[model samples]
Target: MTDQKSKDPLHGITLEMILTQLVERYGWGEMGRIIRIRCFNNDASIKSSLQFLRRTPWARNKVEALYLWYKRETAG
Candidate 1:
């Protein structure tokens, strides 16, 4: 095996890390605009967002996608 997780971009990344970075880069206002989730809209916190994202696959996917895009954008 060639380290299966190596092929995954989110392999070693935690949900909290992703949420933190996204908030740092975009802030709640923009993040809400991008994902349209209530968690990011009203009273947003790492804890609330994490709890919501954990239960919501679609929203989590959007968050992950944004995180990946953010990483690529800032890389260059």
Candidate 2:
């Protein structure tokens, strides 16, 4: 067997960690403005955000984009 690993684009990362970082970098209010998604605009929470991201591919994409952007912009 080969000892190879498939990397996650969002590897070694948790959804809550991504969300927390985004919220810190952009703030929940601004995230809503930027993504214009309901999860950010209406009462945002870790559980709710995870639920949306798990089922909504487009929203998940946006969130992942935001994560990369945040990682770059903030030097995190």
- Identify the candidate with maximal TM-score: 1
The superposed Cα distance between candidate 2 and the true structure at residue 73, in angstroms, equals: 1.6
Stretches of candidate 2 off by over 4 Å are: 1-9
How well does each candidate superpose onto the true structure, as a TM-score? 0.92, 0.79
- lDDT by residue for model 1 (1-76), tens: 5735477899889999999989998999999999999989999999999999999999999999999999999999
Give the range of the ten consecutive residues with the poorest summed lDDT in model 2: 3-12
Tens-digit lDDT track for model 2 on 1-76? 8887657668778877888888887888899999988988899877898899989989988899988887787675
lDDT of prediction 2: 0.85
User: Which residue segments of model 1 deviate by more than 4 Å?
Assistant: 1-5
RMSD of 1: 1.6
lDDT of each: 0.94, 0.85
TM-score of 2: 0.79
